[model samples]
Target: MHAIALTDGLPILDARSLVDVDLPQPQPGPHDVLVEVRAASVNPVDVKQRAASPTLRSPRVLGFDGAGVVRAVGDGVTLFAPGDEVWWAGQLDRQGSDADLQLVDERIIGAKPLSLGFAQAAALPLTTITAWESLFDKLALTDVSHGALLVMGATGGVGSILLQLVRELLPGVRTVATASSDDKREWVRSLGAAATANHHGDLVGDVLSAEPEGVDWIFSAHSAGRAADFARVLKPFGAVVSIDSARELDLDALKPKSLSWHWEYMFTRPVQRTPDMVKQHELLDAVAGLVDSGRVTSTVQTVLHGWDAATFREAHWLVETGRTVGKVVVER
Candidate 1:
């Protein structure tokens, strides 16, 4: 099997940061499926993992979002079989989807959207799961009749899909999203956001101007240095959910409003071996149905046409630029 791997947590600028390597084929464990990867997408988690550790005794593969076909399955796997097309964000604790073949638990894998190609489907799983969990799971937003929600970093991967889900699931809710420019604002609107705020300008004021009473919920893609802004724009008793790590957030700011804070890590179910881990598969299938119905669209902004080390490295560079509109996918 061929894979792009890292032996050290070097900067992307270093030539040795990511390298092409040949590895033995991986075999499936109980409940696992061996997938032949056709396409994968780069996320911030991949970048963070590459730069988090100084050195590794063994090569570490680092792609999470992928679309592929199952070549084999563990004896216990009942959800899928050899020759089944699948998509998923593989567990963080396991070898990721960067390899030509990866062993992923069938519980986390979903049928790929039939309406989409491999690259388009590859760009969705991680972001879709994160966004879906943030809204329906963490926020318990399945029944709200009418309210305003704000999404920070709305043009990014997770935020892009999140807006679409809001439109599809909670039609009564109005969404206010944060975008830095005119183009990004329009882009977010196309995905179903009712309003846009400039993250660079007065974010609190911008959101407040859209909804006079403040938003009912805030979904933040990047929460660093924006806790105060989030606190100011959320109504009393409103909740805020974030996917990024925030070490120095002032919990006190949210105290006055009785605001609740939550962290939505999509890997929680697979990493913790939660009893409901199969929810990922269910949500993914639901999203695929929406895609097939033409109610949603793939968020792939840029596609790298290859399945090699150089292409993967270039995908990382695009994601690291912090200005990518949606996702950067690499496909064969």
Candidate 2:
């Protein structure tokens, strides 16, 4: 099997950072499925791992979001068969999907959306999982009918899906998103945001001017520094959910408003090997249904072919640049 592997921790711009290597095909565990790699998407996590994480004894394969056909299943795997098409954001600790074949736990895999191609399906798993878990699971804003919900960084991968999910699930709720450019603002509106503001300008003042009473929920997908400003714009007793990691937060600033803070990490379940790991499969199934019904669209913006070292390096560089509108996919 051919794989892209990183033997050293280096910048993505270096062509030799990721190199093509031939390795024996991986064997599945009791609850695993061996998938023939069809397509995969690059995420910020991949860039971070390549640039920061320490080099390992064995070359590390780096990719998380993927869609492909199952070529084999372990003895205890019953969710899929050899010919079933599936999609998933594989676990962080495991060898990732940037190879000819990769093994993933069947509990985290879902059937691919019938309406989308392999590349399209590959774009949804990581972003969808993050948005779903952040809004519904962590924030507990499932019944947001009479108030407003604010989403920061609304044009990125998770933010794009988050806007659509909020529209579908909370129809009556008002949505305010933050984007820098008119094009991005229009894109968020197309996804059903009621209002869009500039993240570079005064977010608190802009949102306050739109809704004098402040919003009910805030989902911050950008820097944690934005949380303090978000706290200022949130109503008393409201909640704020953040996915970015910051050095420090002034928890005291949230005291006057009685605000609650929640951190959302979509990889928590899979990384910790939690008891409810199968819930990811369930969520992906719902997401697939939504996509198949035309209620949700694939966030894939660019596609790169061939799962080689050069291609992986290019994909990492694109993600590192932080200008991609949506997901970037690579197909084998």
lDDT of each: 0.92, 0.88
- For 223-247, candidate 1 gives per-residue lDDT tens digits of 9888788888989999999999988
How well does model 1 score by local distance difference test? 0.92
Measure candidate 2: CA RMSD: 1.2
Measured against the true structure, the TM-scores of the candidates, in listed sequence, are 0.98, 0.97
Model 1 ranges with Cα > 4 A deviation: none
Give the Å error, residue 16, model 2.
Answer: 1.8
Which candidate number has the best lDDT?
A: 1
- Clash pairs, model 1 backbone: none
